[model samples]
Target: MEFETKYITADIKLSEFKGNTFKTEVMFEHHILVWFISGETKIIQADGTYIFNAGDIFLIPRNQLATVINYPKDGLPHKAVAMHLTKQRLKDFYSRHKPAGRLQPLQKVYSFPKRPLLQSCLASLIPYFDLGKNLPAEIASIKIEEAISILRSIDKDVDGLLANFDEPGKINLTEFMERHFMFNMTLDRFGYLTGRSLATFRRDFKKAFNSTPQKWLTEKRLELAHYQIAEKKQKPVEVYIEAGFENLSHFSYAFKNHFGYSPNTLIGRQR
Candidate 1:
């Protein structure tokens, strides 16, 4: 699980831990997909404790406090794969399509973390722990996607990993938008990047960011354009094109909306 893939907003890392304690406390600095490969642990959350063992697959949601209390075994070592997920990654995941019945609308079983089916998969991955250390980007990406698919199919609680594909993601969404605002910055493209539906993407992104994705995009373009003009002294048309606006008229309109002045006026003020 130690690899970097295009699909991964954060790199995957594998860790082998050796400690004997009933109670272990630590704050979650990032969202994590925890796959337990060996040994056992008592998962302690605000809700309660769940006994987790070899083959246990679970998720630790970001910003939620939790702890791990190890279940001791004399012969075996404790090992796990923890993939750190950035907010952008979550946003990217939800940018495309919503899967039907992917998530549980109602909460149940406070003792267990979301996505219990990962135990078997994590068990299956025991042999590949070392392969993760030298994973090819394409292979790593495929494995992660497959892992999510399995997680969706087997999970009974939490949101289906695939069910709400249209949900706004954390990392790749902003990166994608910020990267491709000019030529064809369409919602459809955004959805495709994360395997989602355009309609679903629009709904979730608007809620998460508090503006239509397109509107927000236009503003982004305008802001970038102004920065180039004010900071670099680029011409209005040049800045517009450089910022990815295809049409001068459209760029002017968006630039005005964002800055409360014509693009020309701003450039003039600078000159």
Candidate 2:
């Protein structure tokens, strides 16, 4: 199985997949508008599972971890067009349009129902993917603008979600950690996302969870790995990665220390 992406512009990309089934992690740095053409895409996040089929268009919020599964349909390769709305692009648009007020926190993801205008806009951009990196940046920018306009027409919430760009504010530590522990990122990243300095994050973490961030994360991940291995019948290697361990050796060491047996031993007993 292989996945490839062609850039139409710095921020916009066209992705193609030649895979029957595969799992990968995604840390979304920018808000994404996905136009599915010929595949079924399943995204599993902390909140829920979302599936996108052919001719489906959806918006994914930035700053979250997601596990994505792509499957081809009808014996064909998977293909999709993804438009990434980077922070700079959003800031530029906000400066130009100057919307009146700030936006409330929007939904994590938005799936648009069939809309002719949105579909037409996506169709017009399909040909440009063939042009590959040679596609002029100016032309791609125009298409991005057009897409934003169409989305605004379809949903008033679009403008609010896209325009009011700001760094994440302080959030409750427990809630944030519970939703994000599966991500294999540094503590500093977690601190930034929670809008706390490293010192404050550590202090708040201890107060909230009664443990250091590292200790809490390790225990939580191991617990999840145990569930996947013992209950879901998944391999330890796969569970280790998905549960946010750095590698098999560390996971194995920790799993045995925590559970008094190796993961393979558990798998053997299950069999």
Candidate 3:
């Protein structure tokens, strides 16, 4: 079955799926707090992989790409509650309660250690989910505030991460490319994320990688796909998407061209 999701509030959503395991690439537009209520979720980021089981709560920073896998456990559907924190809401909060100073950027994902306060905060939203009621905007905003407050109480550094609402700054082109090649986004987006104009991004990319951005990204993704299929024993269909290819045919064509063999050849050999 295809993946399905439901929105409980403008900012909060409930996602559920059953009878099939699936993988998808997600690019977060807002800061997200996820509560895994059942089954399991594996989130693979540039830095590492994170596995969330039932009752696990984690925060995902905005403007990042990740490969998410959802599968059933104990003959039940996979389920999770996701809260999206919008930039405008965060800005309003920051204006009223300004943090002392900027803190270093947060990690790709912050897995909060189990705490009663955090659990209670999540529990408070259960009724709305059960009733399928849309939370009033004001009430939802307060919930976000409460969640942020809890995070701050647990880790003061969270205040800094939430206070600074700015676009990504100019960063090392080489380093950025190395980390983000698996994201299937346009060159224009890459340019903006790296804090460079399209023309400047192309020039700097050529200087840093000795090739055009498209060429380098294609090669990088195919290389990673090969590794996942040949060494990690993953299926071509799954690896293709994770490696940033938009479709299987495109990934297969590029893989065969690069390696002088079909991707299925590797998968067939593995089986």
Candidate 4:
């Protein structure tokens, strides 16, 4: 509500930018849950490419290493609303569920009434930025909630809206795996990020990549470790840490199972 930087559940915030196409990168480790109100964003990564057009909302989770190329880089011209959170947000979302309306499990997007509804939502948010500039924290939180209500009113699928709460993609699991391979990220986290129930996120993630997120994530980290020892300059222990592993033995075992060789052998062969 008041844009508290402290631990929050359903806080909403806005961002504005105008620019032309320029090579960009993502560094912040928090999952970037966003709705692109205008323009296009292109990302080139180790796997392939991702093109997100206007009217499309997507989730770019943590620890990804992709380059962003935004259209109209010079003029800038971009508007967005983002809700940032860590693992707890995802867990809390599903632990408490609703079955009454289409809003049962709030879609990572809440309910958007297609294109026109989204346009209006974006328009309504403009005043918050204006009001937020002047009001003190106490008053600002109330005003922001008012804005959130306005957003909900326009949503066609409001049946499943989470109480005082919050808030899609295709592509493949590898893309998700590369970006969000940490243990802290649970299935409920995926649902909260994508705006679905834990059940649905598990099903969808499995269908898209033909594997569960957990299994895929393990393979992804091990695969990346192989690449580093075989090609990149990172040492085995360093790559283990970089890939989010807490135990060197765990990394070693997974690496051997994945590539049929241990860290020591891989490093020895590289020499």
TM-score against native, each model: 0.44, 0.80, 0.86, 0.39
lDDT, candidate 2, at 233? 91
Q: Write one digit per residue (lDDT tens) for candidate 3, span 166-250.
A: 8878999888889989987778778888999999999999888899888899999999999998998888987887788878998
Question: Which scores higher on lDDT, 2 or 4?
Answer: 2
- Number of the top candidate by lDDT? 3
Error of 2 at 176 (Å): 1.3
Using alpha carbons, what is the TM-score of model 4?
A: 0.39
Q: What is the C-alpha lDDT of each candidate?
A: 0.57, 0.83, 0.83, 0.55
Error of 3 at 200 (Å): 3.2
| Candidate 1 residue lDDT tens string, 1-271 | 3222222224466655565443444445445677766678765443555677765666665433345556445566666676654445444554653454635333222223445455554444445554545556676565555555565455544344323223334445555455555433356656755446888777767666788887777777677788888888888865555465666898888778777899789767875
lDDT of 2 by residue, 112-155 (tens): 96988888887888787776445687887888888887877777
Local accuracy of candidate 4 as per-residue lDDT tens digits, 67-176: 55566433435555664534454345436543233644332323233556445544554465555454355554544444334444554344243332333333454455
Best by TM-score: 3
Estimate candidate 2's alpha-carbon lDDT, on a 0 to 1 scale. 0.83
Error of 4 at 113 (Å): 41
On the 0 to 100 scale, the lDDT of residue 102 in model 2 is: 31
Q: What's the number of clashes in each of the models?
A: 27, 0, 0, 16
Q: Return whichever of 1 and 3 wins on lDDT.
A: 3
Lowest-scoring 10 consecutive residues by lDDT in candidate 4? 1-10
